[model samples]
Target: MTKTLQKTTALSTKNGKKSPTDKNLSARAAAAQIILQVLDHGKSLSALLPEIQPRMKPQDLPLLQEICFGVCRVLPRLEWIIRLLVDKPLKGKTRIVHCLLLVGLYQILYTRIPPHAAINEAVNAARQLKSDNFRGLLNGVLRRFLRERESVLATVDKHWQTNHPEWLVNKLKKTYPNWRDIIDANNQKPPMWLRVNRNHSSAENYRQRLAENGITAFPAENPHALRLESPVSVSQLPHFAEGWATVQDVHAQWSAILLEPQNGELILDACAAPGGKTTHILEQAPQAKVVALDVEENRLKRITENLARLNQQAVVICGDATRPETWLPQAAQQITGNKSAVKFDRILLDAPCSATGVIRRHPDIKWLRREQDIAPLVEIQHQILTALWQTLKPNGILLYATCSVLPDENGRQIARFLAEHSDAQLEPLPFPAPQAIGHQFLPAENGGDGFYYAKLRKIA
Candidate 1:
């Protein structure tokens, strides 16, 4: 049964100074509401975070994020424990209190938060929730969990312990015969990667600046990419406001490299909101005429902000890619200096998919996405591919990419496209990623997000 909770409740103020108890209660309350929103309403953490974080005490924000992310990451295991410990499930309006228990348990099991403090705060959170009836119940369940924790956790099914849903496990097993590595990768924390803006500084120069700042980073296979030893805020990085660097995964940087954009050529970044690849394409070939397209107008603002910060330029369009006719003509006119139809020399179709690839970075996706999402996503990808192919000039290349590890969306999808298009020819991609049809990058242990890239040429 699905249940939705209201946004977080406000913390009570006492003399403009929130006591330690108040702070802990507020953080737990906010975290519980955030989890309930995602777990029940299908809302994304990315969308809910900015809304909820500001309402929390500045010191308590990080704890709130940790609790929310931790609860989602280990949700299956937490639920298993809850089932084993709690005799009856909390239902309806009372469901969020159950989320409070999950957060409390996560802290006890994973964080250094003291067991007594975690339990007390979670129980107090019921007061903030106005569900005081659950307070004693919460305390009892958590204390019992503390006593039985080791034995109960030892008995958890290995699959649930990993916290991935059963359907996803089956899907990954079918597509990747040896799926343990992929699951492990998804459970592990992702590394911090930075892309040095070539227009301002080389990777070597950026590395030197980082060293001077006492931040250590190692260069990746791509000269422009660096993997930081640890993550720091962008403000901590040198020349961040001047756009000397950007935080992009090493695997994502490959799209611009493989696109092989050239100076003065016209290029289109379809599905390009938040403009990382669009700006990278321009950075690689400064003279290229770039048109960045995305369906969401609100997100297009982020693309513009990145361009302005990087001191780069691109024609940003907000229109549905499936109906390319609405926006393509204007893009063609901008490139050709006339209203005549003109094809782009390169197109980066970063098609939307299930995004099972970067689950570590967005743990909520592991719970939010379902088995039924794949077919519709594949259909959307196919429509985008066919429409964008019409915009690529003869001999021009279209690089199809997704942050998905599924074959139906990666290789099989591309193979079907190649068969249907008489003029389209698939080119072999070179890299360490496993491939039979196109490149499939499993979520890496240390380096990159799971990604897929296939280059197609229009021979006609």
Candidate 2:
């Protein structure tokens, strides 16, 4: 274990408290703790998983992820099951036990693990969590569930089938004609998509290399994208450490393609943390002078790291997109030698949103995101678009993108922007839908996550 995890475990145990990081914590117990954090404390699984995964036995890592993600994917159904099994709701300090029940129930219902093993682990996990008093209760509930599984599921099947929260389901129904399909897509586990780095190899060549390595990846509509038959660790991919490719969704690759970065042109990628698109742009136009900007200093490091891995370079800046003047002029001056002047040939605003589009990849978003959160997010996206428009040169294109399916954050947002800015002209995408101002790609079975892209050109 790393010193950080060790220290955390030490501190958590110092007060004679049974913590999630307790030395004897089983994988099931750890999974329950993570669920507790997400459901009760409103923490994100993405952030929590990393902190705990390192402490897990390597063999247990996949199980830990599966349980946590699976529990979140069908949370409502799991809660419903709990209601039928238990006399009273598990609350307060006992909420961990409720989470333990969730993990156990999810394993039995969703996974290939034998029911006995799943029940035993959860029962043992209860003891590890200092809920030994509830071990009998856990055992009884799980056993009863197995016996009445058919009847219980039959009752749940009669209810609304969309396992999503009521507010989100209602909103989706109001917006999309095919809302049921969208909800079905969200419940699935996402397929793994790879973006072949053109700097190092062609997508075809990379697919060949994967075949040689016993990995199957099929080409997608995007020339640079490949969808894997199944996800493998990055280490398993041929030349992955050498940056032959990056793991990016096929839909996401369209950002760089649509931006059409030209050689020697200046470009800006706002909110470009984790730098997937930033690196993809460099792969397309190696000589382009790019300034990758995001508000978070820590996230900016990801951009730098991705650049280094791909043997690429870009000027990365830590500044809010809502206040570009604070950093854009400095970045422009560094490249053009004019401190007062700032103009990007093209700007890519991968603005933050509700992230409803990537729910399959991040099931925790279902519970973590609230209905009231959309208006505030719309306001922020509006501010960023309004602020960043001034930095684009006349006739330059700014691609507004989001991993959101909501009209308020996607098409409607763009419609409002176009109404406000006469200088902004909405350009056409390859695939157009009537409901959206730009292209809206809904989450698909084996295709891309739900993504919205609108290209706006500044009138000269």
The candidate that achieves the highest lDDT relative to the unseen native structure = 2
Q: Model 1 shows how many backbone clashes?
A: 0
Give per-model TM-scores: 0.92, 0.94
Clashes of each: 0, 0
- Candidate 2, residues 1-460, lDDT tens digits: the string is 0000111122134466745574746789989988888887777777677777666787888888999999999999999989988999999999988998999999998989999999999999987788999999899999999999999988977867787888999999899899999999999999999999887889999999999999999999899999999999999998887889899999989999999899998999988988999999999899999999888776788899999988899999888889977887789778878887768899999998999989999888888888998898899999999999999899999999999989999889999999999999998888846444899889999999988899999999
* Reference-based lDDT, each prediction: 0.85, 0.87
Off by over 4 Å in 2: 1-19, 22-24, 333-338, 433-436
lDDT of 1 by residue, 1-460 (tens): 0001123223234578853334434888888877887888877777777765555678988888888888888788889889998888988998988998998999999899999999999998888877799999899999998898788878775443557988999988887876988888888879999999988999999999999999999988888999999989899999999989998999989999999999989899988977899989988999999999988776799899999999999999988888888987777677677778878899999988888888888888888888888898899899999999998899999999999888888999999999899999888787654446778878878879999899999996
Model 1, residue 162: displacement in angstroms?
Answer: 3.0
